[model samples]
Target chain A: MLREVVVLGVGMHRFGKFPETSLRELAGEAGRRALKDAGVLPRQIQAAYFANALAGLLTGQESIRGQVALREVGVAGVPIVNVENACAGGATAFHQAVLAVGSGSCDVALAVGAEKMFVGDTGRTIQALAASADVELTHDMGLQFTAIYAMRIQKRLASGALTLRHLAEVTVKSHRHGCLNPYAQHQKEVTAEEVLASRPIAGPITLLMCSSVSDGAAAAVVCSAEAARGAPQPLVRVLASELRSGAFRSGAGEELSTAARTVRAAYEQAGVGPEEIDLVECHDATAPGELLYYEDLGFCKPGEAGRLLDEGATTIGGRIPFNPSGGLTSRGHPVGATGLAQIAEAVWQLRGQAGPRQVQGARVALTQNSGGWLEGDSAAGAAHLFAV
Target chain B: MTQGVFRSSTDGEGAPSLAGSRCRYCARVSFPARPICPWCGREDTEPVAVGRRGTIQASAVVYHAPIGFTAPYIVALVELAEGPVVFCPITGCLPDENAVPPGTPVELVVAPARAGGAPVFQFRPLGG
Candidate 1:
């Protein structure tokens, strides 16, 4: 039988543009912090997984990414694995680390995600992000990821399922949450009018509603429950971890989205429902994405996500607080580092260590992350459930 | 302007049609024609023309363009007559609410994807 795994420690380098910092410096800081938090020596790490999505395209760093970065923090001679799954790269790395410990392959494993997008050219960064899609089919269309979200939001607006005001309100909420997060890139709260008036990037999607180009890193340490019996940090159990890829569907069929399917599998594995989830850190690359995930994650009935948000059920201290860490829109999306940052947020909240943004009495937390785009859906989706 | 994605009229007098693949096993159609059927995992598939005429399912006006693209251009997802939905640019209109809203009938045409760029398949409102 597989052994139970627990998160021993987590850390994050502040999420924002860091022109003066190198990718190795960003990753080294987070890794060192995690090791220190776990009170474990660097030599104790049995395996390592490093996640970086755009390094090859932006910085020209191809292979041995994990080994190269981890070595700066004194991690070496171990099975260092490099992971790249677009934006979900961090979660994929964490999943592998958990599996390593749970399957008895090792007692301790490390996961780190880092990205450097501020290469002095905005056009180059945009081009690299667009490569996450099926380039062959979409390269010529001048596709921007924001436009994909805009298309979805436009359909919902056309159907009257959502309104322009609701979109603005969500952005306002994200910014407000970001204000409480020290690591957030856009910490200043925005008003609904401000959000609406911000420069429009796509149909009904203003600049404030989208995640900005950012550079940062996040790291986590996982060990078998037995290994964590006497650990210093509060224990956070890994109840479930699920990853899934998009399935091709023709027409407007009634198939569940990739996010929905992945979360359903996680729920079944954890033997818990959405009602048990006290807090969440979902992939809100755009403001409307959070609203859509409310339904996709089974938090509410179809066509009622907007109503759920209106009820204030997703704000801090609400019934099911979401993105207490400001989500991608405000907390910053460093592509590869985003998923691990979600993990760091969830762990802090579960331990009651989250200061101002803490979801009071939070016992169970869930994180949902997705990456890339394919055939009208995310190419990969990952969901993990944790409890204290 | 990827090669083999679409076919132009031999006489150069008609609109281009997207080249897709139809599975001989499950009859699933995929745009940008796959060598093997995504559904049924069968290699028995044949090239077919698609998206000659379609209805706009969703659309957006992109104000922040990527490299080689101008800002404030319209992009859309159109459901073809054959069943596959293709993402392409929508031309012959301004970026506004009335710019080819969902459900508007459209037809495919070959146009420059960017200023002075190679021709790629795009969509335009029927009779616009």
Candidate 2:
């Protein structure tokens, strides 16, 4: 019989700029914490997956990044697979770990995502971001991601489906929630006017509306159901984990965003409707992104996202708590580590371990993350569902 | 970045046009040329000159630019007359209308890139 996998532990090293720390150090700290939380020693892990983006470019640590980082936590001589799936790197690593345990290849597995960003020149950092797009096609054209998102926003605006006030409200809500998350990069709450008044990164996209270039790490420990017998912690099952690449041509046509396709597969796999999800942590790389995802993820109907926001349906104490960990807008976007951070938050909410941001009686949750760009769509996307 | 992707020479009493690839089997169009047909996964594709005129599907101005690029420049997604969409900077616009709204019509032009950079393919408002 096939075995089930459960996340036995989750850990994070906060989300903020840390020029003093190295990637290995950041990863090591998160790994050790996860091991402690799971009550498992280094020797118990049969295999591991390490997720990191730009380690080679920014930190000069290419190849064997897992071996270098894991060795710091006294883990060695195991099959350590390195994963880089753009912004979905961390969750992809966790997905592989779940597969490892579910396939009975290993009883216990580890997944860690770490990065050290914002320590170099601003222009170089910006260039690294452009690498997410097509280098030969879009990057050389000098396209900025904020500009890319702005194009979508402009289209929506032209259709009268959304407004600038709705965009500002998204950031305002994120900041208010981020203030309660200890690991968030931007913890201070800001008014909607402040978000609009911030320096513009692109048309209609202010600096505050964009996710910060943060440095941090997040780790997870997973084990087979048999191996987790009598484990001294609340068992949270991995109900579903789905990964899909952006379509050059989707059945629904290329006009639909990639996240729309990825989320549908996840929901079908989990057999859970959007209404059943008690909480959610989605890839809000920009504030406008979150509003659009509400429709794409089926949280609302098309062109009704602004109405949902106005109704306070997405706030922490509302009909559904979205991004209780502040999301990328406020929690910080450490690219490689962002996905696992969402996973960690999901696990915490399920285990009732979340302190201030805890959703009352939360039973089911989802995390939708995507990154990279090509041909005007996300290059990769992934979504996972968790339940207690 | 390569200098330009469009041909400078004329084609049979026709105006100069952009170089793109079209799948012979599936009739799918790709900008800047693709070796394989992305739709049918076939290698049989032909080089074709795409029309120079396109409509602006969307537009935005970047205040934060990459290394060696100027800020607050316009970039628009233009749907070519041949049904291929390309991203190009829109030129010859009034300084105030940096972010062109969707549905504006534009035509192709080759110009020196920002700050004396490489020559890049650009789009200007139709009849502007």
Candidate 3:
């Protein structure tokens, strides 16, 4: 007996480092655009759900971030819920909004994710951000994300399942897609030899293979079908949205499968399969993650992600175009805004508004986001399916 | 200090053994103590030291440095013969793919880490 939720509008400020813009300002811009797109005024939003991770750590504003950010946009006195799920915070907020709409609690809800990540020294800022990781154990082991994932790369290479070229192919393809996306953080493409020649951060992972920190914001307006029909344009129905936590609380096994579970469930709830998906905006925090996800999400068989990349299956023109919005690799992972940005990409394609990166006739779209690291995989995973 | 599970320093057994938590609920184990069962989230658990023995499940040789660490290290997934697979750095030998393959038997050793730093755990060839 779940109520149907429809996306009336999606909005995003171009993704990049915007030091002149405050967190609240960026969020306000996105919110304003979304409201306009939905043909609603500021007074129409019934509630606000804000997703931000490092605002407290980097900005020293711990509590009431949602209140502070949204109140500045002239939407005061409504219930404002702040969600912090690390990198997945944006997607998590969207999930809560979906629940709010699906449960018939609120007819119109605004979900916004924004982060300002370039205010200080980049390295120190990244270290402070890493504070979200399991600090005590990671400190003792002296392991950073690069170190942990580098070990995984080494192990996989040792298995003779992949090569450095395969990893480079991942970067090359992402850059190729980003070339057509003006909003991407890194638009310049690179050759495989250049990737191999780049400096190594951790063993086997190079600077070219890693994503950098930046600032951005994305917002989406969710309302019931009744409300959406009243808006200016046709609506994209939220078919199914599901979130799952890490299977292993400590130490890592089954992380890939954890995301897969949410995908399977979302497909079942949406009554669609891998083949029916037109595009996906997924978490590609690193090159290896994208490959693992291809297999994890059943787009291809296990260990075939490398082959998939080599064969041009994940590019913009592929069977199921992935990360056509440039992905985290090229588009920049601005933490809170990433999930809503994915939704925005899907909405743009559904409405036939994407200028160049659009997947033609995209009717069904999927977004997968993985949050903080737990035992061996992400502690939280979320997936959402939308249909036009 | 030749790192092995030890008593207090004055008692002269070297550094203490790395302690972990074992599930009393359903026999699942976790390295670096977990308060509740990862599988069931139950509070029923006990602290136990995996004895100085295990087999390597996977091994990787590091040619680059980790944060706060030096290069030329070995990281391995070791499965205690009885139960539990743990991630730890292997010392005393370069863990190239050929040096320690999956199922290679290893014996725990106690030793001072990196130029007389804190005593830590490492593994070596059991027969050697």
lDDT order of candidates, top first: 1, 2, 3
Candidate 2 docking band: medium
Write down the RMSD of all candidates, one decimal each. 1.5, 2.3, 3.9
lDDT of 1 by residue, A163-245 (tens): 99989998899999999999898889889999999999998999999999999999999999999978999989999999899
> Model 2: DockQ against the native?
0.54
> DockQ scores for all the models shown?
0.71, 0.54, 0.25
Q: For model 1, how does the per-residue alpha-carbon lDDT over B5-123 read when each residue is reduced to its tens digit?
A: 88877536366888899998898888869888877899999988788899998999999898888888999888998888888899877777668887899988887879877777888
- What is each predicted model's overall lDDT from 0 to 1? 0.91, 0.85, 0.76
| The best candidate in terms of lDDT | 1
Model 2 over residues A309-373: C-alpha lDDT tens digits?
A: 99998998888888999999999998999999999999999999989889889999999989898
Q: Rank the candidates by DockQ, best first.
A: 1, 2, 3
Ranking by TM-score: 1, 2, 3
Model 2 per-residue lDDT tens digits across residues B30-125: 777889987799999999888588888778887777787777688878888877777777788852444356667788776554776666678888
* Candidate 2 interface RMSD, angstroms, 1 decimal: 2.7
